[model samples]
Target: MRFPFFSRPAPAAVQPPVADGGTLLETTGLTKSYAGADGELPVLSGIDLTVRAGEIVALLGRSGSGKSTLLRCLAGLLPPSSGTVRYRGTPLTGANPGTALVFQTFALLPWLTVRQNVELGLEARGVPPRERARAADQAIDLIGLAGFENAYPKELSGGMRQRVGFARALVVEPDVLMMDEPFSALDVLTAENLRGELMELWDSGQFPTRAVVLVTHNIEEAVLMADRIVVLGSRPYGTIRETVEVDLERPRDRDSADFDELVDRVYRIMTGRPKDGRPAARPDAERTDPDRPDQDRTERRTLATTPLPSASVDGLSGLAEMIAHRDGRCDLADLADELGLDIDDMLPQVDALDLLGFAEIHGDDLLLTGDGTAFAHADVQDSRALFAGAALDVPLVRLIANSLSGAPGAAVRAGFFRDLLAHHYTSEQIDRQLETATDWGRYAGLFGYDAGRREYRLEEPETGR
Candidate 1:
């Protein structure tokens, strides 16, 4: 199902759909190689893929997979070591016309303001100044960055920075929009909001992309937004599975037996393991009540963290502004959207880290304890390290991974990632990427992980214990 790109497009009539299955972009047995310490490291080999006029396909795999290489080949960023890529029936040797990508990093020019960044795409295409301004305006408004055009990259929050990346892509009105974990750097709430807006624009025909090819590790995200899921096999790189025509239904029922069934299958295939050992899904609020589990479908937690009191207060947010802006905390709205919480949500997660002697929440200001701040700065994705010592006694990474993976459209609170480590993952992996989410939060942290004894023990830690 192709979600239309422009719900409320410009007054101009939409163009007719590009013919289906006629090679909007086609790659035959594509392969890529790079020079490594050992020399001649093969990245992608004999890869075959076809994207139609309006297709959104997900390339799913673990870290070290060749998804990035393939994306670069298609976008013409890197020349393929072997095989061929064809766009609109013509072979593509390099960055072809009419394609744009939004990367995990904003990669905006540090010196350029948001307005200049959005305008760069058009300027590259040689669009005249008058037309460039018009297109930039539309793209900025499209991504909700109307008044922010003049802000430099350093002045914007991570989420806003990402918008600049996206707006640059949209301002050109490319034929295909390719993104590599585009929201991976953002907070859950911000990612959801951006995704919601993108879906609305695409479906409404306001942003009619000819095709969109997104690459991500989050299986639930792939399932939710993609029309097809392409699973890549281990090592030496290539496609092992292409399961098209997924039938989970729209606004997906994650708790439904059917959704789990598909998720289970995909999880097994992607992990090189069978479906038998994976855990169930639950968030912190649900874990609080053992007898009464949180049910899905009716009212899910609206945000990822708890709300603050009725009146505005200082130190409600994190040390974020306290260090940069020189305040313990800031207004909820001043909080970074990419950081995922307003002042209301940030304080609790900060406190969660505090209770385990990981952090301190004083006057609503998030001050990471000595060790907490160290862990916050470390590389925490190592699976073994995630479970180290007493940080997590159970399968906490699996808990968080499953919660995010299974929840799909819903926001997995920031605390879900932090507290899960209280019970699961070796201290190593958690310290690498699982525990420190501010970096790769979008892809890895959202769907927490677990090895076995896989179950949802999602509970808020006993306060001040």
Candidate 2:
């Protein structure tokens, strides 16, 4: 699977640089389904994630449950069937300079020493030799692999080898660091020690990752480490069953009655009865909260589901058909002209829809396929930003599924995120008649327009009437 695979191309104005820190990584409608001998295998579905700077999020699930797959998707190691993985506001492709992954197998080269292994990624990306070397050395020391810098992989212990793996990924100074069951190969004692050390290092900011995602099946480890623990359902494939957050006081004691109760709570959630709607049961504080372990009935309600946005059916076909059927024989140039887009900026979108079986890209002109045409005919209510993010033709359909719940039937909002784009689009540009461009600024979610109201919505209500 490839990275930067968006169900649709993102708005150009949404490009995010390394400096943005508040909200680091977010995934939308992430689903990875594969064709198999029997039938389609759904690995993970509708995985929406958010990782902020300086936070540690743990992915926990039984083996074969696609926790690893989710991590890979997050890392751009795998492409999602229907969704978007955005780093800051931009799409994630391959291994970005800001992100890297450590595999469960510790994919280290036997011929390379610890230091050399760490330098591989940097060198591959064309970093100068001197700087790469310095980074590798620093990473090695941070992971306590300092003395093993010159040691070959064969000479190192399993734990040391994993450390080398961590170092290789860390040298890049990524904004997001992902480890897929990285310590499963080592013995419990070694794994425990390494986990503690890693946590200590991260706490001290010895490693440069803005956020870290660790995948593990060990409930205790996840409870001890993560700010949030995501447990995916077992699968040929399935969606996340539960995500238990640990807002416990630090230095968690496994032997304490509180820890034991929290563990049981998670176990029950995974193995016990399926509760209500999507995010599942409400756990009692005695069962889940690490901080208030002794308080059996804490104030917080567990398993609060985020409200799903109304399904915005901004059918590309609807737009295409509006033009094609209304005008007859729609051509790319004609469509572009109506939507206010240039041929160049619109190419990727046509390619994406074609890839998704949504449209057909014929030689010179494009036409909506049956499914595409169907989508077009259906009315949708989406994040007003759909208009802001898409080529004049296609809509930011995901936002519709995420933000539209209020309107009755056939609710569609325009300009939902127009104001958010204000920072990115110049006054002249916003006034420039939104064609190919859209402001993909931070917190753009707050700037969409309610389709019914036809007014741009602001996070903070605009003062003037």
Candidate 3:
């Protein structure tokens, strides 16, 4: 049977394009940074991107990968620190007149009714009140909010409120629509339903925008909706690591072999494995020998270059144990499915395992190293010892332990490290680094953290030692 959206006819005013249209937006050498305590803190660098009239593009990445930042740049909401953002071949001076944004948080005026809220864009453009009302009604009806036009945002459900957001963006009829995690705030079923309906609208030529650019961290969501998926990499700074074209027909099946294979491929790319099953080079590495395993590249790491993933000892160890139970290897995608998690949710733990030399990713599969297998099988005391050695090898953890050891009275305020980290990271990122370090340090018995005092104290030696 054909997909529901596929069977529907286009609205009278809208017609399916005979062919793909021209470029709507483009970015060249786009780099962005913020001034920090030490120097410039780079978020994105050397980014060259484009969005065309007939395609839906997904910018996919992890938390620090700057997907939203890129979206803002494209929308002309945030100017690039260097390079250029152009709309229809003209360099943007301010907000792009051709684009409208849908935010993650609904961003509705609680005091305004649905029709009034949707009319905000039209009013700003100096559209007459009567014309604004007509456009808002059409948009509200098209998005399935026909009867709720007079209701305030508070009177509607979460899904309904978001429908207002979509209506508001659509009413403007911008050349490009920008969405930043628009469905992520909704429940799973709600998100799925909304996604299906939106795609149906696009397929049926009823969508108001000429093209779409979506910012998301969900791998499956990108595969299911985007005509092209641009994967961003975060390590030192954000860059477009790869772009995969989705050649599958519409109404993709999650259970189909081709769909599953594409998901697996994207999973591998996000985890540092290339399309050919080879490990990608570390962003911070200066290795002269290209044949060296990725683990060896960590020898040159520093706190700024290889900040710790926000993973706890218990969490990472549990992941290790799971892999050991699966005969020391498991497909990462399958493991995420079995655990009922999005693969992005499992990344921190998987990254922790790789960072600590406990595991390695070979294409789509996660393979435990010799140390990982031993640690998984070891008793508590032995596991602690193994973890201590591993943690010490990590730059940030080792720095904290050594800093406390050499301080007066074997203690130092956490603010000292925070200041050092501020040179490289934002306030939020610094907190995550410290929290992860604290967890790992305490677990290894390398140091102790006094939460009330905001201090790191060295662990005393055993009597015999």
How do all models score by TM-score? 0.56, 0.54, 0.90
Rank the candidate models, highest lDDT first. 3, 2, 1
What lDDT does each candidate get?
A: 0.56, 0.58, 0.85
Write model 2 residue lDDT over 347-395, tens digit each, in one string. Answer: 3345444433345433334555544554455444333333233322223
Task: Order candidates by TM-score, high to low.
Answer: 3, 1, 2
- Model 3 misplacement above 4 A: 1-19, 281-298, 406-409, 461-465
Pairs with steric clashes in candidate 3: none
TM-score, candidate 2, is 0.54
Q: What does the lDDT read for residue 437 in candidate 1? A: 32
Better of 1 and 3 by TM-score: 3
- Rate residue 104 of model 1 by lDDT: 90
Root-mean-square deviation per candidate: 17.1, 23.0, 5.2
Per-residue lDDT tens digits for candidate 1, residues 139-211, read 7877899998788999988889998898888766677889999987898789878877887777666774677
Instruction: Point out the higher-scoring one by lDDT: 1 or 2.
Output: 2
Q: Global CA lDDT of candidate 1, please?
A: 0.56
Of 1 and 3, the candidate ahead on lDDT is: 3
- The candidate, 2 or 3, that scores higher on lDDT is 3
